[model samples]
Target: MPLARSLRLARLHPPQVLALGFIVIIAIGAFLLNLPIAFHGARDLPFLDALFMSTSATCVTGLSVISPGEDFTLFGQLVILTLVQLGGLGFMTMATLVALVAKRRITFKERLILQEAMNHGSVEGIVRLIRRVLLYSLVIEAVGALLLSVRFLLEMPADQAIYFGLFHSISIFNNAGFDLFGMFPGRPGSLIGYVDDPFVNVVTMVLIFLGGIGFIVIDDLLHFRERRKLTLHSKVVLSVSLFLIVFGGLVILVFEYTNPLTLQKLSFPEKMLSSLFQSVSMRSAGVTTLDVGGMRQATQFFSILMMFIGAAPGSSGGGIKVTTFAILVGAVIAMLRGKEDIVLFKRRLARDRVNKAITFTLFSFFFIILGAMILSVTESYDFLGILFEATSAYATAGLSTGLTPQLTGFGKALLMAMMFVGRLGPVTLAFALTPKHEKELVRYPEGKITIG
Candidate 1:
C-alpha cells in the first residue's frame, strides 16, 4: 500500500510538482524569516512582509518591501541568499544534488520534472546537464566572488568585504538582485554608488549577462571545439541578446544624456557605463547603478518593454523569453515577405513552435495588463508606475520605479501572484490548474476568418 502510494505521488504532473516545490520553499523561507533571529532590532517583522520577501527571494524577483541589510541580521540575510540560490537555480536542480549524494539513480518521473525545471526539450542526458549546470554555476560564482571581494577589500574590513563579495556575486550571477548595500551610509541603494566605478560596473554587467544568457548557450559555447558549430537556439539567443543590449544602451544614453537627475552630471565615460549597466540589468538583474525612478518617461517605458521581454529561456531570469520574442518577429517577417513557413537561420520553424510562442506571448500580455489594472485601482501610484511595477513583477525583472516599498497589502499580494506566475510561467501554471483530458477525436471543418 505504501509503495502504491509512493508511485501515485510520483506520477503527479511535472508542472504541478514544480509549482508546489516552489510554494513549499517560499513557505519555509517565509517562516524562517519571520523568526526573531531574522531581524536586527525589537521591531517585529510582519508575516505579510516576511511572506513577501520570501516569495520575492524564492522567485528571485527581488521586489523587496524591507531593506535586507538594514532590517535583517546575518541569519535572515543568509536565508534570503539561500533562497536566491535555490530559486536562481530551479529547486529541482538543487534536488539533483541530494540524489547525487544518496547515490540513487534519478527516477524517470524526476527526470521529467528536471526537464520542466530546466526548460530543456527532452529527458535525454538530463542528469548530465544538471551536473554541468551546477559545476558551471559554482565555478563562475567563485571567480565573480573572488574578483568582487578583492575590489571590496580596498573599501572595508577583510571579513565584511569577503562576505559582501560572496553575497553580491551570487546575487548578481543568480539574477536575484538582492543587495546588502543599504546598511552603509551614503550608499543610497542597489549599485547606485558604483555608477562611475568601472571595475564594479564591468564585473556586475558580466555576471548579469552570464546569468541571463541561459545555460544551454554556455554549454554549447564551451563545447564548440567538439561540436564545431553553435546550435540554432544558441545562435538566436546570442544574436537577440546582443542586439537588445546594444539597442537598449544606445537608447538609454540618447534619452537620458541630459537628464539632470540621472546621467547628465556624469562624464561621457561614466554616462556610458551607467547606460550599459542599465541595459544589462533590465533583462532581470534588478541591480541598478542609475536612478531608475528619475529616468524620463520615455526611458522608463522603453525599460518596461525590455523587462517584459526579459531573459532567455532556461536561464535564471524570466519573461516571455528571447526565443518567444524572436519567433514572433520571425512570424511577422515571414507574413510580410509572403513566405509559407517561418524561417530562422535558414531553418524552417515548426508550426507548433510558432503557435506556442504566440499563445505564450498573448498570455503574458494578458496577465501583465490584469495585474497592472488591479494595482492601478488598489494603489495611489500613477499609471506608468503601476504598469512598470506590474510588468517588472511578471517578468521577474525586479526593476522598480520606487513604488514597491509603498504598496498596500493588496498591492503586495497581487505582485506576489505575478512573481509566482512569472517564475513558474503562465503555461506551466495553466497546465497545473487544468485537468487531464483525452486527445480530441473529432476534427472540425476549417472556416474562413475575417481579415485584419
Candidate 2:
C-alpha cells in the first residue's frame, strides 16, 4: 500500500513536477540563507523572511523585504545570485545542462520536463537548445559584467567594482532587480543615482531588454540567415515588445515631463534616457532609475498596465506575456471585423490558442485584483499603491510604490503567492491543479449560450 501511494504521488504531470522542483530548490535556498553567515553582525534572518527571499529569488521576482546590499553578507548575495540564475534558466534546464556536462544520458521523462519548461513545441534538438542557451547566457552575462565593471570603477576600487559589476550583471540580465546601491549613502533608491549616467542607463537597459525578450527568440535570430525565416512566434514577440517599449516610454515621458520629483530637473537627453529605462524595466526587469514612488499617478497606473502585460514567453520575465497579449488583441480585432480566424502577418492562430490566451489574461487579471483587494484589507496603503504592488508582484516586475517594506506578514505572504503563480504562469498553475488523468471521453450535442 505504501509503494502504491508513492507511485501515485510520483505520477504527477510535468507541470506539477516542475512546480514542485522549484519549491524544493527554494526550500534549500531558504535553509542556506537562514544561516548566521548569510547575515551581517551575526543576526539570524527570520524563517518567513528567508522563505520570502528564497521564493522571490527562485521565481526571479525582485520584490524583497530587505535590501540585499545592506542586509546580506557576501555569501548571502552569492546565494541569492545563484537562485536568480537557476530560476531564470529554469530548474529543469539547469538540470539537463548538468546531466550533459556529467556525460549522463537524459531520459525521455527529463526531456518532457525540459520541453514543458522551455515551452518548446517538440523534444527534438532540446539538448542542443539547452547547450546554446547556457553558452549564450554566460557570454552575454560576462560581456555585460565587463562593461559594467568599467563603469563602476568610477565610484569604487577595482575589487569592489568588479564584485558589484558581476552582481548587477547577473541581476539585470535575469531581470531579478536585486541591487547593491543600498550600501551607498542616502536612501536605497535603486539606480536613481545613475539616471544621468548614460553608460549605466544604456548598458542596464540593453541587458534588461535582451533578457526580457525570450531566449528562444534570441536563438532563432542568431541561427536564422534571413528575417523571413524567423519563426512567427519570434516575429510577434519582437514586434510587440518593441511597440510596448516605445509606447510606454512616450507615455512616461509625457506624464512625468514636469513632475518635479522625477524627470523635471533632468536635461532633455537624460529625460529621454530615464523614460526609456523606465519603459524597459517595467518589462519585468524591476530595476528603476527614477523614483517610482514620486512619479505621477498617471505614470504609476500606466506602469501597472505594462507590468500586467510583462514580457515575452520563455524569458526570465513574467506576466500574461507579450505573445498572449498580442493574441488577445488579434482576437479582439478579428471579432470586431466578424472574421472566423485571428490572423497575424498572414498567419492564422488556432481557435484553442486564442481561447487559451483569453483565459490566461482573464486569470491574470483576476489574481491581480484579488491580491490587491486582499492587501487593501491587511495593509493601510491606498488602493493605487496596493494595486501597483500586487501587479508588480504578479508580473514579477518588482517596482514597488514604497509599500513593500511596510507590508504586514499576511500581505507579504499574499504577494509571495502571487509571485509564485506569476512565474509559473496562471495556465501552468491551472494544469498543476487539475488531475492529470482526467479526459473528456464522451460528448453530447453541442450547446451554445448567447451573451454580451
Candidate 3:
C-alpha cells in the first residue's frame, strides 16, 4: 500500500509533495483550531487568526497574535503542539517513522521525497539518518524537559510544572518558541520572566543550539570518537555557529548594557545571560530574555542580520542558513584573493553549491524586502519594525519588535505566505512551482561580459 501510494504520488515532484504537505496540514490544523472546542470559554477564533497561527506553528515559526496559553484551551494548545512537532521534523520524517514502526518498506520514490524534505544529499542511508534524527530529538527533548520540570517544581504545583516543562521543552527544542508563561497575568512572558534563572536559561539555550545545528551535525558529533574526525560540513557549521553566538552576544551586551528599558536593571551576570540567550534565540529560537522592543535600534538592526543568517541546514530553525551565509563570505574572500576556488578547512566547495547559495540568499532578500514594503503600506508601524517582522517571518526566526500583533489582516496573510516560503525554502518552492527540465542538450557559445 505504501509503495502504491508512492506510485500515485509520482504525479507531483518530491519538492511539491513536501510543500503541499505543509499546506494540507496547515489547512487541517486551522479547521480543527477554529472549532469551538479548541478555545477557552465562549471565545471565537476567527478563521484568519486560526489560519495564521496554524501556518506559524506548522512552519515552526512562533509569530502569534493570540497568546497560546491564554486564548487556547488544552485541546487547542495540543493542536498547536502537534503542528509544531510535524513542522519541526518534516512531515515526511513522521511518515517515515510510521513506516518504520509498521514494518513497511520505504519505497525508493518515498526515499526520494524524504531526501528532498530533509535536505539530504542522496537517498542512500536516508532512513538511517531519519531514525537517528528521531532518536536524538526524543532524547534531547526528554532531558531538557526533565531539567525544566525539576526547576518548575520550585515555583509551581507538580502537575502544572510537569506539563509546562514538557510543552516548553518540545517547543524550544523544535525552535518553535511558543510559551505557556502568558497564562500568568502581568508576566512579560517568554523567557523574560525567567531572565535571572541560570538553569532555565542554560537549558533553553542548549536546546536551541542543538536544534539549530542540523541533524547531520548531531549524528556526526555522536560518532566522533569512532570516526576520529569531523566532516567538512560539520566543521563549518560548528565554527560558524560558535562565532555567531559569541559575536552576537558581545554586540548585544555592549549595545544594551546601559539601556534603561533593557539591561540597565540587570546585574552583570544577568546581563551576560540575557545577551547570550538572545543571541542563541536570534538563530530562529525566538524566545528572549530581554525586551526585544526596548533594545536600541542599532541592536535590533544587528539582530535582523543574525535572524537572516539563521540556523544550519536540515535543522528545525530557518533562514537562508549559516552555510549559505558562509559560502557567500567565502566566495567574496576568494574573489578578493584572486583564488579560483572557495576553500575552507582544506576543502574546496563545488561551484554549483556556491552558485546555489548565492541565488538562495538573493531570493530570501528579495522576498523579505517585498514583504516589508507591502507591510509598510498596509500597517502603521515604522520601517524598522516592519523590516524586523518581515525578516522574522521570512527567516522563521519569530523575533518581533512588537509589530506582529498590530498587523492588519492583509499583513497577516502576507506574513503567512512569507513563513510558508521561508520554511520550505525559496529554492524548494521554486522547484515545486515549476516543472522539472531535462539536462541541457545544446551547448551555447560563451559571450564576453564586463566584470564587476
Candidate 4:
C-alpha cells in the first residue's frame, strides 16, 4: 500500500490512531533521551535503557532501571517531564489543544479520537471539555507548585526549590511518580524526608487524588454546585475512591504497624500519615515516603492489589480502573443474588458496560500474570516480588519493590511492553491491532453451558 493509503486506513479507527500516536511519541522521546546531552555520566545510555525510560515516562509509569535524578542531566529531566505531561493529558488531547490554539478546524475524525481519548459519551462539548481539562490541570498544578515551593524554599536555594516544587507538583498531579529527591542530601529515598512533614504529605496526597480522579468527575463536581446533581459515574468514582483511600490506609497501618523497617520507628501520627500516603500512592502515584522493598509481605500483597485496581478511567493513572472493578464486584453479587441487573446508586448498569468491565478486568489479570511468569523465568527474584513488579508495571502504578533495577534485559523489555499496554489499555491495543469485523447477516443459535 502507498503511504497515503496506509495513513488513511489508520485514520479510520480512533483507537489505532491513539495507539500509533503514543508509539510515535515514545519513539521520539527515546531518541531524545539517547542523546549525550541528556545524560550527566561519562557512558552513554544503552538503547534498551533509553527505550525503557521513554516508555515508562510516556506511559506515566515511574519504574526506572536507573535513578533519574542522579543519572539524567537537566535537559534529560526536562525531557522526561515533557513526556510525563504529554502522557498524562494524552496525545489526542494535546493535539486538539494545539489545533484549538492554531485556529485550525478539527475534523469529525479528530473529534471521534478526542471522544475516545477522553472517554466521553458523545462528541458534543468535547472541545469544551478539553479546554476545561487543560485549564483545570494548569490551575491545579500551578497552585500545588506554589504551595510546595514555599515549603521547599525554607530548605533549599530559591531556584532549586522552585524547580523541585514544579517537578514534583507535575509528577504527582500526573500520577507519574518520578521524583528528584535522589539528589537531595540525606534524602535519597523518594519523599521519605517529608514523611513527618504535614505540609508536604497533605499537599502531595491531595494532588494525587485530584489527578487520579477522572476529568469527567472533576467537571461533574464543578458543575454540580449549579446543577445540584452528580452523574452516576462521578458518584461511583468519588465514593469508591474515598473508600479505597481510607480502607487501604487502614490496611497498611495494620499490616506494617509493627514492621521496624517501615512504620515502627515513626510516631503514631507519623505512622498514620505514612500509611495514608502509601495507600494513595499505591493506587496510582508511585512516590513513597517509606521503603517499599522493606515492607512486610502482607503489606506488599495489599499494595499489589491496590496497584492492580489503580485509578479512575479517563485519568492519567492506568489499570482496569475503579469503576470497572466496582462493576465486576457488583455483577458478581447480582449474579449470586439472582438479580437481573447489576445496580448501584439506585441505577442499573447497562449490559454492555458490565460486559466491558468484565472483559477489561479479565484481560488485565491475564496480562499481569503473563508478565509475572515471564519475569519469574528470566530472573531469580521471589514470586511475590515478581508479581509486585509485574502488577506495578502492568497497572502503570510504578510502585516497585526494588526489582525493577535488577531485572535482566529480557525482563526489562517484558516490563516495558506491560507499561505500554497498561497505559494504552488492552482493549485499545486490541482495537489498534485487529481490523473491524463486519456483522453477519445470518444469526447463530446460542448454546447454554452449565456452570457453578
Candidate 5:
C-alpha cells in the first residue's frame, strides 16, 4: 500500500515517473545482460556498453557500436528482443495488456496513462483496444515472419534460415533493424555478405515498410471499412509517403547510378530497384541494401531528409511523422487562402493539432541542433557527419554515416538522450512535465510584429 501510494505520488510528478520507468527498464535489461553468461564469444564488455546496448534495444534504434552476434549469447539476444518489443509497444501498453491477461481490473488512472502512452483518445473500452492492438501486432508479425521465412529457406539451411527470418521480421516490423547478419555472418560489409541477393532485399524491404506505416492507420482501415473515404491524416500519410519514396528513389538513382562506390555496377533495373528500396527504407526503417558509408554527399543529404520525415504516427517508425508535415503544409495553405482556418477534406482543423505539429517540428529540430552542437564540442568528427548522427538519433531513423561506433562517451550519451526523447516525443514529455494552465480571466491587447 505504501508502494502504491508512492507510485501514485511519483505519477503526479510526471517527468520522474516517465524517466524512472525508462531507467528501471534499462537497469533490468543491463543487469540480466551483465550476467557472466551473457557473452557469446568470450569477450567481456564494460558495464556501460551493456547499459548502452539495453537503451538502444529498448529504444528500438539500431545504432549499436557492437555486433549482437559476436557480443551476446542467445539469452542476451532474447532479452534484447523482449526489450525491443516492450519499447516498440509503449511500456504502459505492455503493462496494461499484462494486467488484462492476469484478469486484474484496471484502475481509472491506469486507463488514462495507457491512453496517454499510446497517443489515443479517451475511448470507452480502452482496455479492449489494447487487446486489439496486441492481437493485431501478433497477426501482422506472424504473417511477416512466415513470408520472410519462405524467402530465407533457399539460401540458408532450415533451422538457421527460420531463426534469421523470425529475427529480421520482428526487428524490421518494430523498425529496430538489429540484424543478426551483421557483416553478413559477422564479416564486415556482410550479413551473410551477399548484399546483392534479390530475395533478401525484397523480403527485408516489405517487412520494414509494413512496420513503418503507423498502426492507427491500419486499425482505422480495418475497423472503419465504410470510411474508405479516408481521413486527412491517412490521406496525408499515404500520399506523402508514396511521393517521398518515389522522389527519393529517383534522386538516389540519378545521383548514385554513376558512382563507382555504390550502384554503378548494377544493371539499370537493379539500380532502380535498389533506389526504390533505399528510399522506402529511409523513412525510419534502417534496413539498407547498399552500403551507407560510400554514398555521395547529395545522396547522403537526401537520405537524411527522408529519415527526418520517417514513418507515420502510431507506427513503429519515428520522425516528425508524415501527418505532422502535411498539417504544417496545410497550415501554410490556410494562411495563403486567407480563410482564417486550416481545413482538410472539408473538415475543420483543431488549433491544438496544428500547434502540436509545429511544436513537434520545432522541438525535433532544436533537439537535434542541441545534440549536434554538443557532439561538435566533444567529438572530433566534422559538421555533416555529426548532424547526420544527431538527426538520425532524434528521428530514431538509425541510419548512419558510419560514425556511431566511433562516438566519444559524451556523444553516445547525447545520442541515447536523443533516442529516448525521440521515442517519448518532445510535446508529450513537455505536456507530461508542464503544470496545467488554469484558465486566464484577462487577455492583453494584441501587438503587431513585422511580416515576412
Candidate 6:
C-alpha cells in the first residue's frame, strides 16, 4: 500500500518506474555480493567499490576499478557475473518469461514493462516471445560453452577448465566481459597465455559477437530461418553488425600487422585471430587479448567509435544502438534528398519513433560529454584518456583506456553516477526526474521557424 502510494505520488511512468526498480535491485545485489557471505575469503573492498562493481555488473558493463580476479574470490566473481546475466537478460524479462513458462499470467502492467525491456512492439505475443528468448539464449550459450570448454580444457585441468569455460562462455555470450583473470596485471596477459590457441579465441569472439547482436534480431532470424524476406530491423542489424565485424577486423589487422604494440610480433594466425577478437570486442564486448592502451591513436579512436555505436537495440551490448544509428542515417539521407518523409526499405517511419531516436542519440552524446567534462575537472589524468573512459562507461561499453583503476574517490563517484545513468539511460532517468504531466487543455498554433 505504501509502495502504491509512492508510485501514485511520483506519477511513475512505466519506463522510469522500471528503471528505478532495476537500479534499486542491483544496488541490493551489490550489497549482498560485497558481504562476507558471498566471498570465499576475506571481504576487504570498500563499500563504494562494491556498489560500483554491482552497478557495473547489473548494467552488464565490464568496467571495474579493481580486478575481479584479485579482489574477490570465485564466489564473489560468480556473483558479479550473475548480476551481469541478470542485467543483460533483464530482471523483468526473466521474471515474465518464467511466469509464462509456469503457466502464470502476466499482468497488464507487467506486459508494459516487458515491452520496454525487450524493446519489442506493443505487448502482443510478449509472453511467448519472452519464452522464446530464454530458450534461444540457453541453446546458443550451451553450444558456445561446449566449444569454449574444449579450448579451455587444453589449458587447465578438467574441472577447472570446464568451470572456467562455462563462466567465460556465459560472460562473453551475455556480453558481460567480466573475467576471472583480474589478477592478470590489468593487461591482456591473463588471456595472452591462450593467444596462440585458435579454438579459445574463436569461440570467445563468436560468443561475444552473437551475444551483442540483440535478442530481437536473434528472434527475427530464428523466426525467418534464413527466409528470403527479412524484417527491416533484422536486415539493418545484420547488415551493420556484419560490416562492423569485417571492416573493424580488417582495419585492426592492417594497422596492427607489424606495429609491435598490438599484433605485429604475433604469428600470422594469432595476428588474424587477435584482429578478429578486437573487432568483436568493439561492440562493447569488453574482452581483449591485446593491449588496447598500447595501440596507435587511430586504433584507439576507431575503438571509441565502435564503443559509441555499441550494439544493437534490445541486445546485451549498450550504446545508442545499431538501429538508432540506421535511423539517424536514414533521417540524414531524407533531409539531403529533400524528402519530407524519412523512409526505410519502402516503409514509412513513425514520428514518435524518429523523435525518440533523435532524442536518445542526442541525450546519450550529451550525457557522455557531461560525464567526460566532469571527469576532466575532477581527475588529473590526461583529458583524452579520461574522456575515453567516461564514454566507455556511459555507453556501458567497458573499453576503458586504462584509467579506471587510477580514478580518485571523487572520480569513482562521478563514474558511479555515470554508470547508473548509462545503465538506466538518459530518457528513462529524465522521466524519473521530471514531474508527471497532466493532460493539457489548449493547443497553440505553432509557427514554423526558418532553419538551415
In the range 254-278, model 1's lDDT, one tens digit per residue, is 9999999999999999999899899
- Kindly state the number of residue pairs that clash in model 3: 0
lDDT of 2 by residue, 121-229 (tens): 7999887888888988999999999999999899799999999899999999999999888877576557888989999999999999889997899999997986559
Itemize residue pairs with steric clashes in candidate 2: none
Model 5 agreement with the true structure over 126-173: per-residue lDDT tens digits: 777788789878987788788777877977788877787777778878
What TM-score does candidate 5 reach?
0.92
Stretches of candidate 4 above 4 Å error? Answer: 1-10
**Quality of model 3 by C-alpha lDDT:** 0.92
* Per-model TM-score versus the true fold: 0.98, 0.96, 0.98, 0.97, 0.92, 0.91
Where's the lowest-lDDT run of ten residues in candidate 3?
A: 1-10
Off by over 4 Å in 3: 1-7
- For model 5, what is the alpha-carbon lDDT of residue 292? 83
lDDT tens readout by residue for model 3, 1-452: 35337534678888888888899899999999999999876758889999999999999999999899989989999999999999999888998888889899888878888899888898999999999999999999999999999999999999999999999999999999999888888989788889899999999999999999989999999999999999988999999999999999999999999999999999999999999999999979989988889999999999999999999999989999999988999999998999999999989999999989989999999989999999999999899999999999989988888998888999999999999999999999999999976889999999998987
RMSD of 3: 1.3
Order of the predicted models by lDDT, top scorer first: 3, 1, 4, 2, 6, 5
Backbone clashes, each candidate: 0, 0, 0, 0, 8, 0
Task: Give the better candidate number (5 or 6) by TM-score.
Answer: 5
Question: What lDDT does each candidate get?
Answer: 0.92, 0.89, 0.92, 0.90, 0.77, 0.78
Candidate 2 similarity to native, TM-score: 0.96
Q: Residue pairs in steric clash, candidate 5?
A: 183-190, 183-191, 184-190, 184-191, 184-192, 184-193, 185-192, 214-315
